[model samples]
Target chain A: MNDETLSAVDVRDAVKRYGDFTALKTISLSIKDNEFFTLLGPSGCGKTTLLRMIAGFEDVTEGAIFLYGDEIENLPPHQRPVNTVFQNYALFPQMTILDNVAFGVEMRGNSKAEARRRAGEMLELVQLSQFSSRKPSQLSGGQQQRVALARALAPEPKVLLLDEPLSALDLKLRKAMQLELKHLQRETGITFIFVTHDQEEALTMSDRIAVMSAGELQQLGAPTDIYERPHNMFVADFIGETNLLEVSVDKIAQGRATCHLGGGHELTCNQVDDIGVGAKVHMSIRPERLFMSDIPAEAESLKGTVKENIFAGTDITTIVALAEGPDFIVRTSNSDRGNKRIFEPGTEMYVNMEMGAGRLLVD
Target chain B: MAGGAASGGSATTDTYKDARGWLLMPAWSVLLVLSLAPVFMMLVYSFLTKEFRGGVIWEFSLAAYDQFFFDRGLFGDDPPVIEWTYLTIFWRSIWQAGAATILSLLIGFPTAYYIATRPENVRPVWLFLITIPYWVNLLIRTVSMKFLLRDQGPLNDLLMSTGLISEPIHIINTNLAVQLGLFYSYLPFMVLPIYAAVERYNFALSEAAADLYANKWVTLRRVLLPAVKPGVVAGCILVFVPSLGAFLAPDLLGGAKNFMIGSLIEEQFKGNAGNWPFGAAASMVLLTMVLIILLICARQQSKAGKEV
Candidate 1:
């Protein structure tokens, strides 16, 4: 790797085991410099384990991790040029906001005056200059979180690890802070590796995301790539709302595969490699990608009875049941064009997916 | 009738507030009468003259206070010479108590840290074990030190048996023995408050410090120590005050040689000395010193509380 574009953090088959239980399996990924990388997963899915390992809080049971092209698996947390904004902020209750921000700078051997001046600048950057002399307990939760961020960033670390830093805030504050954090990351130009279980936050703020489940990496890519083209059943189910149908592949040609849906309905989908012909596969079509019509608009359209219709203000979800298959959900925006043709429960409808909208799962 | 009832209700509410206000009177009155009255009497007695009898005379005099500084000719024609005997005893008492406080803190902090770091399920058991020494009376505990520290006691016997010493060492009637007794008797007082502080502490703050590039020692100095300082101060005061006035340990362990301020006061009051006014003056001085120390500690604690 060139020095100019060397990855900020790289993990080579990193594994974490606690006694007999494995918290994270062999996971290998790299985070680019100046990128907003997110580890998105549910609780106990090894996302936090991976983040702690990168931060030197937990040792790797196997494999190695590198920071800025240097192996740091053996170094302690303090020796590493990395800092963390812990889930609870973990501000020092005894120190004022200015002192808290100056701590890291002082630890790095800066003079007291220099450290204090830098701390002042950081407090101003967080728009908390007036709170410089106030104790952390006196600040609100959002303010404390900003102080935590400023403190972690004051040292100008190579990478900043945030472990669910915004999870403690209310919904309104969380939404506001998410954008603020993204903006801060851009302004600092420092690599940020954030860990969170909220997919919406990840999609909105992350430049790239790694979806993890059961000690395994389900998928790693940009937000739109992971959401629009999930590699398997877990990724497709975890990222967003989707309709998965059990199907068998009939033939594979070029980048598309013809599959036989239930009730012998033959449909073609954009298939990923490694799926052989005549093998059982699950086809994923997002709810918003499926369109409802009164008559057959395409040659391979499938017909079903509308089992239920849900009105959710912005969109109307129509649940359809095939003659011999499970129920499928089709979401249509509540636009004026959509209101012209209303299909209530028990209405007969034909469903057709948009071109290139369906994907065949490899597993 | 409605207006009258409303007025009655207001009167009942006023009575409730008055009752709540006086709720503390019982405890306060007991403390004032039983504890403060004697201290107040001692303050008054310190200014009187010592009679030939065991009691004090009603005549106001500065003889006792003067005698605290001048051994002879306190008010005579000869120049009042300065004396170091009583001052030496006071100094010795202060230094011994300070040593005991430091030793207790050194021993107590690690023990408290150990208990604090124990698994939650087993922490209560450790705390209970630490408090077991308190169940035994302090006098008995202090007296038992003689069995271990005497010339032919178990400690010397063990040393002789190990061939580490040619003869049995005498430690029973020494200042070292007094300090050991004080340390042993008051260890739990030092440990409990520090334990409470450590137990209530959130260790994530230390981790945050470490994440900010601070090593273990730095983290302890900057984070852990400041966080637990209030408990350390409380423990120090608890140990120092009693250790300064410690009479039984020095009386039994040091025989007659140690002669701490506590023993000095005891000698003037009831021993062959029979100097009631002198003893009252010494007691008053000791009380004044302790009060000043307590005021300083309270002020520092309040300052710390405000910052935190």
Candidate 2:
């Protein structure tokens, strides 16, 4: 990496174990300065555990963690230059909003007046200065979340760790605060390591996402890279909705693997490494990537019967069952002109997957 | 039609509320009769004069109050002098109770914290163990302390055998002994409420405080202490009020040196003092003080509740 890409937090072979259970396997990743990095996974996939390790709330059982190139594994939580927005916001219930925001600054040995001034600035940043005198319970969930963010930022820590801060809000409020949080992160230029099990939230806000499963990192890359070019079965399936079709590899040429979808229908996918001819693999194709057509197009296509047609508000999800293969789903956007044709069940349709849309998962 | 329906709905709600209130009257009356009636009786007795033998004269008099404040003149020429004996006893009772409350808190908080931090599966077991003291009668427990602390008791014998002390020390009839007894008796009250608070506490707040660069002590002050304040205050009140008027501990542990308000009332009513009116008067004073403390606590709890 270049000097400009110096790591704000470099987690090296970090492992967390609770007695006989290993919550996080040896995991290594470097979060860049001022980057919005998200640890996205299902619950118990160790995303929160890794975030806690970086926040110094958890001990690294067997590896090191460096913050700004300084080894911080042995440091106590108070000594680390990192803060966490807890899952529940965890605002001091006894204190006013102003006092809650001022707490971190005061803890850093600032005078009460000085801390109040900075805390006021943070509250203003979060657009909560008007509610400074109110207690945390007086505010709504979104308001409390902003206060938590402001409070964590008041100390000006190098890294900010958010543990599902928006999970408590309703869907609409969560969507709105997602953008606000992204904008705040950009304005403050703080490296954010956000943890969430919500993949859509991760895809919406994260600059890069580290997808994890079963205590191991499945993939670490930009959102589009993880979404469009997932490295394995877990990464492909976990990050978004996908249809995993079992296929047999027939040949390899020019970085593409020719695979036989059952019933002699041939399809070629951009091949991942370590799979040779005659190997069984699952071809991961996103539901949105499959195109439905009345007539077979020039690309590789399979004839299947329409199993179910689901009319969602924004998209039409058509599930198709191949004559010799498992069922697959194709999602197409709804058009305003209202001239789109809908295929009923038992109708014969050609399912076309564009070249490079499918990833061969050998795992 | 909407207005009429709305009025009818509200009328039904009003009748329902009235019925609920009427149903609660029996319980309220029971509380008034069982709890307040004795206090009201004591208030009446406090104003009456002591009879020649033992009963009250029913004639309203300030003799009890006068006896509390003034010393009788042994000679005809000398005027009644202001005495500090009863006042000293009263003040001593307050401070000793305060000390016991503080001590109980000091001991209870850590025990509660330890129990709270234990794994969820074992928490109920620890709580059960803490409450095991309640299963034994407090008198037996207090008397057991006498056996453990007497000069030739097991504690002193063990200390002497370990070469920690050369001679047996006297600790049975001192104010310290009374405090120990009170502390032992009321510690559960302190622990249970603090444990309840700690059990409900979101430890994430402490972690957030620490993550904000607060050291351990600062985290305790800013996060843990304030979060558990209601429980601490409750524990203090529970320990303080009863310790202030403690009769058994002072009687059994302190012998005669310690005379709290409880013992003073006991002395006036049935001991050699044999002054029923004076005992009632002292009981009234103690009740007033306790009521004031209770009011302050109620106000504090309400304020804390609102803040939360």
Candidate 3:
């Protein structure tokens, strides 16, 4: 967040290809020192390829990658001052936990005693000091993952690249490790680059997130900014639960555009570029941003029939069907218990979004 | 009481559901009989006396074994003592067989590794090529090598034409020719096991070794070789044991002067010895040596398997 933090990595127009198929189109991004950055995308979105290229495991077909002002595109993985925690943890089954953690330092030509000492310190940092003598096969999945992290960290690399490090873990362990990893990064004050497809994990863990789709970066911003002020409908829908209501702009004057939604509901909002009057548009609204009324309320409110009520632990997810098209989901918190109780399936409800809550995009 | 009784009956029925359950004891007894028959026969024959009429006399005598240990001649009543002839043949057989096994390994290991590292689409084709030699008869293959390496064969013609030699080389009747013949016949026996071991290998382990900072040689020494050593040992056994017992390759490729233990046993049985008891005794000695080799091999395998 601070400009004073050194730029640790600067990827310039990186392009990767495998034969005729292009895995990553030309893309550019920079990461600051000590920053926790994440590449969040679906499978085959080239996120892992991007991470591998940065880790020096993969060579870029085009473009250059600079580490702290030194071009390292041609360097092999071992020569780079970076280490990767592979997706499968990639722990050496033949080695004990202590030996696995000491591997990188040993590769760097350090004495066995020195590497072990530094590796033991890292294992202690990851709270795995007592597991030094045990082989990887003897440890639990979560413990092996910690050793993987400790192994990557033992070399004191300039950047620690993790390729879905916790993806192999069960739900409960993954959640716990997520917090521990953040704390570890904070304590160590080292740059961490994490890759994950889980949007929730990205939103919770990343200081800055790069959302990629179909081999191109769709959006890059801080977690809150990427979620709240997404550049397009794709980013908006992909980041979280959203209701995209098709609309048309009537007029755009100054910074505001008056739009008409389904069932003739008219609204006025700030105009985004490329959206014209009489042209098709969609207004994106987060579920919590929309309020539900038990009965018909006002002219600005739209009417829908409640189809299903899903009771999540703290919130109720109510799926509503409009007379026009696809159903919309509205999430109401437990504090609004009385209103949800009054609204049930087959009951008519009024949906209204606050003016500033929705993002207007031209389709 | 009814529920518990019903459950107990069902459990008993489940245990005896298959036909194998009924025949298990008989099958095990048959296997036991078949495996121990040779050792029993050998023990009995070892104690029998050899009569002048070439028949075994079951009168409890260790005289044949004593004569074998001390006698030097191939046959006759007043043979020379000190078994130098049999010892020389045994020593030569081992040296030749050992040479064959090591040479086969040197050629087989790299070929197997190369086949294993090939991409998925090409692996089957290479494996097929390695096995194609077996479709041709083994005797034909051995005899074909004779034609290829004889004094006037194409090999000597090429050497003479190239001026590398002034005359055709006499390689057909030597120990080196016998070893070469043994190696050519059994190299595939060494390859297939090591290939299977290398094929089942996970390339990910090699990558992990590299990531751990092991160079190519260290990775090969510490990780790759140990992973495939069992296969190597198994291949050596497959090549060595058969080569030691081989008579066809040596008979076809070398002169009668080059005799192995197998040829000696053949000579006593069907050649001038005309004594079946002495031939059986010689076979019994070969069998003892084979048992020792097999025991050492099995012990090594178990020790290696336990270390992991």
Candidate 4:
């Protein structure tokens, strides 16, 4: 393939405007072949709108989308070579499960025998062949979801768009289907564009994540890169729980900043950009990265009093009040053995950080 | 004492179920007086001997049925012949009712769809417009329709002035005018049920079909029409049953020339040949045809319901 067709989907400066209000401001992204890409954000953040535009349900208001070097922005939804597993499944209530899956194949000019044969194979792939003759209302939600997946995959489109397919499932079923969906994508080797509002699902299933907010892309990278090195405050705060501390830079050297916290506590953390010396900025550190320790570990430690400890199943969380800076939270694995290391309330302790644990968020 | 009071309350609640049989008394009386009694009277009177003017003699006879199937002659003595007059009238009534139902379905489906797809606040206004004409009496509406369809009416005047037609066509006393009156009278029945069904439909199913390579017409045929079929059937029944026995449309609009079943039954009693038994017999046959149609519809619906 040539360079232009190397990527499965290439979106350039795509903008979606609903009347006077802009839903997506000039956004651009590239999805590679066989890659599981996720668009993650809260509701009304334009993630679903972008997915619909790719599926041709929404028109391209400004920019172009190229699929395999072909501009398909003007194509109607039925003419586009893409399919979507809708959020509500949207299975035809009047059709049998087998007929629902065969509908796409028959509409694409296949014979009845051929369509039914191919539909059978797709239903087998989704492990729902036993429900071939049943209506959609007769099946359970999970079974109906599988039927929807089979129907969308029957056409074997170039890209499969999933709009929160597992949002309607229970917690345990959702956890199970997450793995199933990831395995299905890998098995089929089709480019999958999944849209979801769940941060955890995005982190667990997607090879790369695009975090969006307020009609714009906040950050786009691999899950680890997005989690460990957020580009701004919004991405860091939106992705997961993080404690953003107020600190003033004293000096910058070797891509790290020596900053000062209150109560004469000094620390060195990785800096995202050169903000110059003595400038006040916010730095983010994960709660799991900080731990209670006895060693007064030189320049990467802070002194605080233990305020509370909450034991939550597998992990114990401790809230500590620093001498002058914001209160800090520390999480540690729980154990059954008795030990004196766990501190009670009003006990003064030193909180130590691992190397390269905290990074500066530049906005 | 507290336990005794609680038991008393429980006993009162339990006795409510036993007293529930009285709740159906009004319905039972309504069925007996309003429906079953009339039908039973017609069935008995159909087989009785006809008197001279407008009453029946209390004697069991097949003369009414014999008058229907084997017309002796205009006089008293002749070989019996197969009666084509009454049979032709029934067939005409059936054909006209079927055409009116089909016409209403064609126009009603699209109108209901348009009203359903509008914004929620404007939908009631459109429905009000559709039903406003029906608020007038049916007799007045039929008379007004006759005036509009006459040769010198505004419809012909507008058509002649527009040069679409060089002459005023006679329509007021035709079968076409009768069908027009029936369609106008019962169009709301067709539109309302379909509108309700379309309103309850999930549009995401249409979107899903479009996503899976089905265009607009294909989506409507395969997905939408099948889902709203119950409503369509209901609308057809509502329009067809009443149209089968309508007298006003065929009388005022059709000029009393061709006798529909409604007019035929009416002529037996109110016209110069006042045969009450014959009228009652015709009513029984019409009732039987309607019962058969409703039974067929019920069977179709039950069969459809079992698939789901």
Candidate 5:
């Protein structure tokens, strides 16, 4: 075999600085071969900067990067084996679609005929074979995006960097392109490092995601690992919707802690590190995890008054006002809402939750 | 879009209301008086017979075109020979204008790119500096160039002082001086349009080019140049058309050694020849040439309308 391990892209303590303002802090991660990895964050979170560094557009200020298990920290963009699909789909306007797609291969010293043939195959792979002769200006936004993808893939790069390629499309088009991109990744088996701010897009396509914020990696895990068990408030709030309630630890034993909610409801939850008895901590709960009941079926249920009920097509959200804490939101599917009636305003009800629905965060 | 119709006016016609047609009358009348009437008069005068002095006779004649195309003996009885004099003058003018255009492009393209790449606030200062010399009259600038380029001027003095040359290089009253004057006169025309095009260029395309394995030079040749070609063509036309008909540069810097089209036409009307018909014919030919260049440029630009 091979002398190298499974890493397709390895970033080691990368740092990027412009004068004194650091755009990316020390970030290290190893992307597995053929894995659809994502760098997800809000705008200005240094996610695109990291992707640029991988594609060799931006120099690494302090650390090293390896591509396909070979060191490429000093390689220029043209010499590197990684290619990027730009956010705006920067297709050459003067060239036909086939020529635009063939450009990279021709630049790599391939014959014009060979590059053209390879480009034709790539266009067919993207289902744009009929548009090969048309200029990029003649194509629509979604079509140009596919052309950009085809152009980047024509080089047969070991690692493909996509910088928010689907953001320019309408919602329906974005959704369709998402599925197409996933299928493309599977068909090519190329290591895809996608950068996006859309968490839903990341969760839907990425095999694993690295969540970044303010130049630091907050968490890196699979979608369910991140959404079910967030390490901090930022990741929990960013990845998906969650309600954080402040609770004080009453007792701790056997890796479990007894906590008192702000409304004087006592509950026991799985313990988290760095918490002492009587210490205030944050508890996160997803809205879909909670249910409404007229009669208390469990002693741990919290009693509350119905504040407002909101209907949002597929799901109905019921807001519950506690005696001394923030309002609790309970979500149920409309089908479930048919089985369970929405309590009218000012009616007292018990809010029940299943086990592991509430997670204790250190911060 | 529907708001305009809801406002109770005829929105189907657009913002140019029917009543506003009267507002365009002053501009149209001025154009007809200043442009159309002069061109019409020139066309009529070009076909009429030339008088002894500067006036044109009402009788039509082919004498002006024949005089331009054929040369006669001193006694006016020899068989007509093809006259290459005016054609040579016109050819030289075209050559000089083409050289000046190329020279300005060589200098202005880099200057424009430099200014366009600067920080947003600092760019205006550089553009202002470029326009500062232009604000002064063109004649004054040409005269100043003559002063600076003369044999005993500061340029030769500085070169001699630096030990680069033992003897002062003679640049005054030569074709080189006229070319330099023309380049200086219209460099701004080249710089401004290219600056606008470069400013509007998407830098992401450059990055994408690099990602697609293009080095800096290849990216510029294949992508950047093609994207900004319309601006380059506009700059060329702006410089070349004006340079073709320019009289001041050749007169002031070229020392009147050879006849250019402008000077030949000037001689017919104002110099010793005083032939109004020949002057009008030369003017019509030059006007037609410039119009053809402009029409070709417009058709090519509209054929593509810009890539993106």
Candidate 6:
């Protein structure tokens, strides 16, 4: 029996520093074998640094990294079982695609013939077998990206790190590559650690994601958990669109709290931690969960005036302004809008939502 | 009211434009005149007959050109014989310069690479050190090398004191000494061009090569070398051209047996063997040789740059 735990990459309390600047704070995570893990963050949020560290380009100042259950923290990049596809897709400009792909294997003491044969196979895997003799400069952005990916995978690394590999392409191409990469990861069954600032890309391709901010890991969870149940305001605002309304707790009884809005609307929501009656808190409701009504609903509804209306594809988004708080937005299907009629500017509208749809967060 | 139209008339405008164009004629003529005068004078001197009084008489003759190719060294076989000395010196100068250039490129490349990879705040300081020796006179630097290499100098003293040698070595006044001086004098020139080239290096390419399974040496040989060839070639040309024409280092540090073309040309202008016409002919030949080399280097650089 192999008896290995089967997690492809394991990082424990990883930290990186450059003189006085700490580029990566203490981070710990375990990526399951063949799992598509993503590090999502804004620029300079240590996503690229962490990726470099995994690829052996950057040394971990304080941490242990394990690959296939073997400690690889002190290993040099060329000795590590991980390969990185850089953001710029750093394909060797002078060499043809075949030589570029064969380079890693050639370094590993493989004969030229064997390396070329394996490189040819990898090019076929990436659907670019015909471009073997073409230089990287001759290829398009997407083609170059695939070549970079093929080059990294030619060595059959245990983990492949992609540092914003799809960012250089056009929007349409980026979307296509994202899907292609996901399929490629599944086909190869190698753990892929993708780093990007694009939330949509992370949510679409990752099995799990680690969201970082200012060199610190904010939250690490599955994509749905990160989007639907973000731990803090940063994650909530970062992952998707949300409407945060400042409200005061009117009363609390049996795992339920009554929130009083400034616009004279009262609502009952599921109980959140560390809240008392008359204490201020922020209520978060996703735009898709809010609905419009002619009259306020019984349990969780608020009154406001329609400030703006947008006809988005497949949905209508209405921005409603309460008398005392900021503007609130609600998105509903255009078909649903036909029944209740989305209001125009200056029209008084009652916003309705399920009590379970609203989440209260302490200030 | 009619004065505005009269001033803007065709003749007035035509003269106004012509005046601006004509104004630059003298400056342009002066530049052309200044650049062509020495070349024309040198060509005239090359064909003139030499007078015993150390002057040339323009009698329209090729005697000086003929004599320059047949001239002998101050000390050689057959009492300053003609055959083999001139051709031998010509080939030796090129051979020495080429070797020194290759050595300089080898040493300067990695130094430049390291400096280029340094942090922005420290890069300037490292570059400053490379350029500091250049501020001193080249002759002074060449002369100082003798002190560091002479029989009683610290290098020999240390080697002998450490029992690594029984007698002081004969390093100073040898072909090796000339090469050492050539390499040192031209090292900074080589380094700067390479540093400029390497400063633009993208680590992405090496990482890409690594992912493709290239080990360190393979990456350097296949990817990095081609990427930095322009700088390497540029440095080679920078070092080789000047080293070819170097006179002081060979005179001060090299043995009397060592002779470069520059010293040969200089000897004609000085000593009892002063022959200005022969020297002028030789100088013209030397100038042509340098021009040919420079043209070739320029072509090679353009080709390398286009590849990148």
Specify the CAPRI tier of model 6.
Answer: acceptable
lDDT of 4 by residue, B1-308 (tens): 99999999999988997888888889999999999998999999999999987889999977777777667743457767878778788999998889999999999999999999999999999999998998899999999998899899989999999999999999987888888888998999999999999999999899999999999999999999998998999999999999999888998898766457888888777955789899999888898999999999999899988864
- After superposing candidate 2, which stretches have Cα over 4 Å from the reference? A1-5, A335-346, B1-22, B72-80, B162-164, B271-273, B300-308
- When only the first chain is scored, the TM-scores of the models are 0.96, 0.96, 0.94, 0.95, 0.96, 0.93
**Model 4, runs deviating above 4 Å:** A261-265, A274-280, A335-341, B1-13, B73-80, B269-273
Tell me which of candidates 4 and 5 scores higher on DockQ: 4
Interface RMSD of 3: 2.8
Backbone Cα, N, C clashes tallied per candidate: 0, 0, 0, 0, 0, 6
TM-score of chain B of each: 0.88, 0.90, 0.82, 0.90, 0.87, 0.81
Per-residue lDDT over A1-363 for candidate 2, one digit per residue giving the tens place of the 0 to 100 score:
446667999999988999999999999999999999999999999999999988888889999998888899999999998888999999999899999999999988999999999999999999999999999999998999999999999999899999999999999999999999999999999999999999999999999999999899999999999999888888888888998888899999899999987677788888778888999988899988788778997887889999998989998898999998788888887873154346789999898887788888858
**lDDT tens string, model 6, A1-363?**
245675788889999999999998899888888899999999999999988888888889999898878888887777887888889988878788898888887877899899999999999999999999888889999999999899889888888999999989999999999999999999999999999999999999999999999998888999988887776667888888898878899888999888877767777777877768888878888898888887877757677899998887998889998776678888988777556568779999788886577777754
Q: Could you tell me which residue pairs clash in candidate 3?
A: none
Q: What are the per-residue Cα lDDT tens digits for candidate 5 across A1-363?
A: 355575998899999999999999999999999999999999999999999998888899999998766789898898898898999898988899999999999998899999999999999999999999899988999999999999999999999999999999999999999999999999999999999999999999999999999999999999998899888888888987887888999998998888888768877777888778988888888898888889985745888899999989998899999877778988888888666667988999888876768888876
Model 1 misplacement above 4 A: A1-5, A248-255, A258-267, A277-281, A307-313, A321-324, A335-342, B1-15, B21-26, B37-83, B150-172, B268-277, B305-308
lDDT of 6 by residue, B1-308 (tens): 68878877967889989898789999888877897787788888888887774777768777766665656543345455464666677777888788889889889989999999999999999999888988999888988898999999999999999999999998988898898889998999899999998888887787766655567887788888888888887888889988887888888888777888778778777866677787788778878887899898788777765543
| Candidate 2 i-RMS | 1.7
TM-score of chain A of 2: 0.96
Task: Pick the winner on DockQ between candidates 1 and 5.
Answer: 1
For model 5, the superposed segments whose C-alpha errors exceed 4 Å read A1-6, A334-344, B1-21, B51-53, B73-79, B162-166, B271-273, B302-308
lDDT of each: 0.90, 0.89, 0.83, 0.89, 0.89, 0.85
10 residues in a row with least lDDT, candidate 2 chain B: B68-77
